[model samples]
Target: MQLNKQNLTAFAGKLPCPDYDRGHLQTGIVHIGVGGFHRSHQAYYVHQLLKDGTPEWGITGVGLREGDRAMAEVLQAQDGLYTLVNQRPNGTNSSEIIGSIRDYLLAPDNPDAVIQRMAHPKTKIVSLTITEGGYNLNAATEEFDLTNPDVQYEIAHPQEPRTVFGYLAAALRKRKAGGHPAFTVLSCDNIQHNGNVARRMLLAFARHQDPELAGWIEKEVTFPNSMVDRITPVTTPEVSEYLFREFELEDGWPVVCEPFIQWVVEDNFVNGRPPLETVGVQFVPDVSPYEKMKIRLLNAGHSVLGIPGALHGHPTIDACMRDKVFAGFMRAFMDQEVTPILDPVAGIDLEAYKDQLEARFANPNIRDGVGRICSESSAKLPKFLQPTLRENLRRGGEIHRATFILAAWCYYSDQRHNEKNEPLEILDERAAQLHRAAAGTTTDPISFLRQESIFGDLSEQPRFVEAYTEAVRLVYDRGDVRSLMADW
Candidate 1:
């Protein structure tokens, strides 16, 4: 009774089989950054379409690096088969072996193959899940850095390129030459107006390399904004074991995620797309409001909690949330700090949204990484914290809490005092400067707080600068994250 693809068809009581042949499903989408989240989220939706006899939207996944090649190898050996395990605190559910990924492209192995596929008349959508840092962008300008060695290599040799922007620009050039209709470049990353960010980088890269191609892209491409959400972690043996025992399949690359999922997409397509609305994908006129809500609220909330929680020696989000102090910190950060400035989406209840966030954070089964949230703090801070800080400062509201959060970040990045006594693995571009600014044990700690890139022009404002200075001083001297503020 082992649940291989054959027996897994009806594994879910609610999930039914397609009336047609899933193997006949052909590739219509070329997905970039085919990692765990893309596999668990977008691929899961496509698999649902397959189960309902929609075969036109199968994916040809493209991996940008050697690590991706290993993932591709696993899926290819399993015959493009994998399982998705969805769990909640109370129970679990599983998907049959997914076959929606028709093929994978290793950029180094066959860049031509990927280029040809992207240039294909039938490939309607090009989706991306490359993390924020992968954009290789200038943190201040939000533009691609042509000076980056990867970008320089991609520029010099257009063929057999490695960067996402390079591959995308090359593929679009092919389509433009082929007289093929342009594809929609849907961004599935968590960045704000990610479609715009992707467009800015790609077009900027193209303009630097070839101005004509940039013009063609402006005329032909549809970079639609999207907001995607899910909580899927890196796959581990415990997850593989869960899939094997529950589904009775030995999937080499299984994706386990929380039960919650959301995708709000712009209703524009060039070559055509799946009936994904039938599978709960919301096609909307705009995704900005939704994007802001998720980014400022959900993602910012995670960033707010992640460092403090990690420094306190909490292993997972749930474990951190279980501590009364952490829970209260989340509430105050959301209610007192983040919510006041947020304009609620049309149907969203701010209170209920807060409640759901708390519930999601408390889901013990979903072990989201502290490090994952901590990466690219230089890029992330402006988007996540600076906005709220500006709004609060404009109103002369107290931002002591937000300031303390920044102090925590500086300390964490400083790494001189991690409980393990190991140095912090800071990944920021401004690390050396920030380290020098923070040098010497002093009670008047605005030296580090004066980082203009992170604090922005707002650091010039006397009130905001004073508050940040005092907050850093208090936290460093007290040596207790909670004691930095007596209220919480």
Candidate 2:
């Protein structure tokens, strides 16, 4: 049977389906960027709330880019219903049909409709999962980039907004003029202080358009920082095919993920918020310590294995974790390098959390792609790994493994193929610059480290330079990542 409202009751005995009335659901949230992460994480949470009888918190997902058109079509065709499959480490699967997404709007097709939806009084929250780079932050200055052509276009033509910031400014301005309360802007991205970052970027864009409107948003709006965690991989055709073969269900866009899911949100919504805390969501007074611990450990751990794993021909994170050498290296990096820099996260056992991370990475069924983890390294490394590296360097702590990871990244950037002759896909935004700098590592050993925007004077540090240069030589000259990791 096809996955939709009509076929909901048909799958009742086969798997978990929404037990509530779908027609009574109302849209209280307008989420921008309806990607796999949003579907599996935030949408899933709202689905749980609906299942528990809170029908006022349905989601209206918005897609700003043309790439989101496919998702729009799939969700609309399925009546905004899709299966959420949780693949367990023990090779078992638990699937549920999430029904919190009541509608989807492709913003590129109808930007006015999206702005109007956000401007509506019922949209108490406008959330985002627009990745790390979507905030339009400058890597060097750590501020909103007004020089971007898209941003400039939005600034010039505010009525027909293009970027997320443009859409937000337009919507919030309408809300203010119409005598409606401004909604909370919740950011569910992986960045530390994600809400603060969102607020700063949106206010910057709004101020550029109109100073008075920016002042209203500054005083009236609240952006709640949230830390969301889930191992949702990019959807492959195999996922839908698996659903068809096993459960006799046809879902054009089903989400598949590991059984682990977490969302730590700050309890600071301005408009009336949903009872999300009752549905396994942790409402915290402060989210800093939690975000710091998660980013430095889990996010950094992915990079710890990603570059070397890709170079060594490991196809997935689980593949790298299966190898004793790779596993030991990652463990050592976490315990010796990252753990010391972390503050005491309230109510969380650090050692147990590390163990859980290892288990999560080793889940064979998840098949988390190494290339996916390695993609956008230029953006990811600055937030996830570089902070740990800087802290270790300042405190005279263990920097060998972290430095070697950077060397592996440079080696990976310079190479065309892994050890197994599989093509190494360079997916970073600064791929060209990375390749150019890495190519000069043979003659000038510190070329890659000289990227001031990324490394920030780390090339001048003799200790870091010595370790990174030796690591580059070991990996590039010998072409033996396994031996280098094993010896380290």
Candidate 3:
């Protein structure tokens, strides 16, 4: 079946399909960033709600960047319908035609069209999955960087806004003037306290653009913190070909993910929300414990596990999990270095959670890109490792494994090439600067850790500095990633 609205009925019997009248779906969620993660997780959840007769929660997805045009076109052609393929390690696969997305608009094509969608009276929620860096925070200060070129341009030209925050502030202004209640701003990014980050940045942007609107937002809006998890790999052509060859499905952009999925949300939406709990979403009084646990444990654990594979030319995360040395080191490292600092999270067994992470990483059917974990190490290392580092330093915990990860990152940045001698695509804002610093300073690890943005003052501390220097020298000595776990 060529998966589009017309072919939907013919394909419905082949897979679990939306049972509701697709025409009856109302657009309530104006989601910004219709990426793989959002489609496989949030949109999938909304699809379940619609199937169970939940009203007015169908998503009107918005794409903000020029790169999103391709996705926008695909969703438009398919009538906001696509397939989600779950590939499990247990030798089982499942496919479903998801129809929760009611519409999509490319904001770069027409900014006002998206602003108007956000201002719509029926829109009760405006969500985002615009990645961690998209928040535009000053890495050190954690405040909205008003001086960013795009931020400056958007502030100057409010009507033709370029940034997400600019569009949001403008939309709220319009909605308030029209006597409409503010929509809940839900952030699905993997940022720590993502809701708080969104609220802070949006309010800051609005205060600079219009102080009155900022006040209105501070008094009227609700930004709920959430913890969302799913191992959705980036979409590739091979995925589509596999779907067609296996089941005669021709989905232009089918999202492929692991079978595991979870969402823990704070029940604090200003405008009413759908009964998400009906579909297994855990609505909690506080999401901090869950958020911290996941970010430090699973999210941070990704880099801890996958980066070594990346350095060694391993194609996928499963390869890293299958490697006996890498897998063993991670199991011991987490037990010793990562888990001790965590405060008790409600209803979570840390030991069992660690076990599940190992199992999830070993899911060979889910070919999650090693590059995905290694992609933004510059930004991610600070976010993921600093908490553990700081706590370990404070409480006299061992940081040997943590420091090795740092050295591994520094090594990867310098040796940003694979076994084939092709340049590895490094996706980081500080890539050139880090490489230049590390050009010949492998023995003197201080040159790399002197990057105050990444390492802060930890480079000056004797224990961490010694550990980092030893690890870097040992690994760089042999130029082998497997040497990371060796006693340096």
**Highest TM-score against the true fold, candidate:** 2
Between prediction 1 and prediction 3, the one with superior TM-score is 3
Give the least accurate 10-residue stretch of model 2, judged by summed lDDT: 452-461
Residue-pair clashes per candidate:
0, 0, 0
Scored against the true structure, residue 293 in model 2 reaches a CA lDDT of 92
Show model 2 residue runs off by greater than 4 Å.
none
Evaluation by lDDT, superior candidate among 1 and 2? 2
Q: What are the lDDT figures for the candidates, one per model?
A: 0.77, 0.91, 0.86
lDDT of each residue in 318-437, candidate 3, tens digit only:
898888888887777788888888779888889999899899989988878888887877777777777787789888998888888888878777888864466678887788988977
TM-score of 2: 0.97
Output candidate 3 Cα RMSD. 1.7
Q: Pairing residues by index, what is the TM-score of model 3?
A: 0.96
Q: Which candidate is the best by lDDT?
A: 2
Off by over 4 Å in 1: 1-20, 91-95, 420-455, 485-488
Tell me the lDDT of model 2 at 153: 90
